[model samples]
Target: MDARGWDERYGQTELVWSSGPNATVAEQVSGLKPGTALDLGAGEGRNALWLAEQGWTVTAVDFSRVAMEKALAAADRRGIALEAVVADVTTYEPDRSYDLVLLAYLQLTWDQLGPVLRTAAAAVAPGGTFLLVSHDLTNLAEGVGGPQDPAVLQTPEQVAGALGGLRVETAERISRPVEKDGETRHAIDTLVRAAAP
Candidate 1:
């Protein structure tokens, strides 16, 4: 989906994603020293707000104005001032580098995803970290939940390969409980945390 499509979807929904940060992201980066952070495709600012509360200066980027407004509101409620911008993550560029760059559950085709993520990863400041979490391609058979389109799902090796010059901190397949039709299923996810090299 493109920016307009995401905008429409976000406008029609009160909250499309969970109000909390992704579990893997939280666990992976929780021990890192807090600093400036960038949340790419930040929906409703959940991860951004959480990072801000944890003492990181956060910038939340999304394509939907509605999502930014909601994120700002959430940040205000928490007494944390989070910077939010409504822009296409594929093209948006940061003014300054950040200590942490986070991409959580960004479902995009390989062709469309690669360049954009490469751009975002480049914005990580030296000594900073880049984190990515997405539904694993193996999830189609070994796990459950997430977009059915295989184009968006990637293997851990694929993710590692896509990133250049980053020290691989953690690359593993993780699981999450997915709720569907009043039942819970396991979702296999690929998690990667790399430091800018």
Candidate 2:
């Protein structure tokens, strides 16, 4: 979606997504030392805010002005310092590298996704990590809730292959439970974690 579309959607909703960090992201980051972090496509700054509370310096980037404002307001209410930026994910260039570069649910076709993923991976500092969690391509046929379009969903191999220089620590499909019609069904996701040398 474009920035305007996202801004409009964010303007209409109080919280379009969960207020907390992604479960898998929290689990994976639990053992890592706190450091500078980047959250691209950070809609409401859930991951960024949680990371800040964990003592990491975090920068949240999203294309929507409304989303950025909401994230800032939440940051203020929580007495947490966050650097939020309004920029396009496909074209954004970080000013410096970070210890943790996170991309959560930033869906795009491979043509648009490849360069951005590579750029984000390149922004990882030495011994740092680049983590991604997105709706798997298989989520459509065999999974519950997520985008129905096949163009936006990604596969584990596609994501792992995009990380040029990092050593891939984990590249596999994982299961997530989703509530639908008062029933909990599962959704597949591609989780990719790579570390810089």
Best candidate according to lDDT:
2
Work out the TM-score per prediction: 0.93, 0.99
- The digit string of per-residue lDDT tens for model 2 on 95-143 reads 9999999999998888989999999999999999999999999999999
Whole-model Cα lDDT of every candidate shown, in order: 0.87, 0.95
Q: Model 1: per-residue lDDT, tens digit, 92-158?
A: 8899999999999888789878887788778889999999999999898889778888999988888
Lowest lDDT 10-residue stretch of candidate 2? 104-113
Which 10-residue window of candidate 1 scores lowest in summed lDDT? 1-10
Best by TM-score: 2
